[model samples]
Target: MVMRWWSDRWTQSAGAFFLEKDAIFFASARDFLAGVLAAVVITCWNLAAVERNAIVQASQKPYQTLSSRYLYKTHKAKSGRNIHDASFRVYRSSPAMAELLLFEDIFTITGIDTDGKKFDKVSRIEARSEQFDMQLVLDVNIDVYPIARTDKFTLALSSTLRLDGTPDDGVFDQSRKKSLADKYEYVMYGKLYKYDDDESGGAIKIGVYVSFGGLLMMLKGDKQHLGNLKLDQRLYLLMRKV
Candidate 1:
């Protein structure tokens, strides 16, 4: 069942709008929501420290065009002129296929065909200012695979990601700039999952092993050791589609 209710919106738009952030609640009691809500997540958007008010400020800027007002502004800026914007639109949809616009400050596209083939690519992204401007023209490639119970376990790899840039906020870059790179990246591999349902509470279990190398390494250069990291994969007891 679906329900609609009214609440206060902090923005000056000054009208009631539908709340699209749905929650999937699992219930242990029969009186409440007895099962988990099937809120599927095909995409995700991650924003930094910016708040709801910052987007409102950006929306009112003179740069906003007449035709772009309907797009959803998902990203936010913390200080000065740094800002980001994104929008997701369904470009095409059919009985068993779909194409979606992946908007995460940057823009990209993903298409899933009826025959289970998928294509993902990232194109041009623009960010400009009065003093400096940079445009990301790199193309992104994505690959996916569906694994079943019998799939064998694989090795893990670890690596680092480095970010380097200096701000122009009245500070001089005297060649001694600091980097925003990753200290270390950790990785783990899980092969088996075990679930039990009896009078004792239902439980799900999985077997996992870790490695500091291979595709699991997400750290930058070996400047320092920030200690071992933990995995961040969600768990679910998946029942095979018979």
Candidate 2:
């Protein structure tokens, strides 16, 4: 399965960890196995990088708290097409903030598909946090349709962030260049996959949808709301410094 995925153009481009084509073109079984092992190791390493230490461990201590939120939206016509958007939020916040903002914030959105079929869009996010610097990390799993496509894939995304300003520094100020209003930048990465029932017998064709890169804005905020948070195929979110 790994070998076949390696041969796919999408997987190669998404992961981009394969050896040179010539190195594997006519390789022996031993070489193929080596390539598979290399790919697995590289993939795991990359995932760990995106997951970040904030998610797995925080300095010498576990995170003091966890906070999470989820938002899901849908738009469908009487035709046969539909658009769904969702986001999962996990950040470092005080236990009080987590309970006040997310613990009971539950709602659902329902609509009719283009085929006149009824569908429901439900989402949720949960985590814990602290007040000092707002150090945070998140792991998001989404099963939805990507932008400009008619199919759905499960996207696993993760990142880390920490608030570095002070209350007097205008954490909620939008006019200043370095204010909390600035884009919250982080390295974002995820893998995309499709469920296929083919000659491989209902195998899942997985590919690296996105790899590690920073300068990509993950979160932003105004005095009242976070903006420009539509990451990886329309994962929109709103946030505020608590």
Evaluated with lDDT, which candidate comes out highest? 2
Error of 2 at 103 (Å): 11
> Which portions of model 2 miss their true places by more than 4 Å?
1-104, 112-236, 239-242
* TM-scores for every candidate against the unseen true structure: 0.14, 0.16
How well is each residue in 3-30 modelled by candidate 1, as lDDT tens digits? 2222233332343222221222222343
RMSD of each: 28.7, 26.0
Count clashing residue pairs per candidate: 15, 16
Candidate 1 Cα misplacement greater than 4 A, ranges: 1-56, 59-69, 79-108, 112-138, 141-242
The number of the candidate with the highest TM-score is 2
lDDT of 2 by residue, 93-177 (tens): 4553232221111211121132332223311222222211111122222233212112221121222122332223212344454
What is residue 148's positional error in candidate 2, in angstroms?
Answer: 16
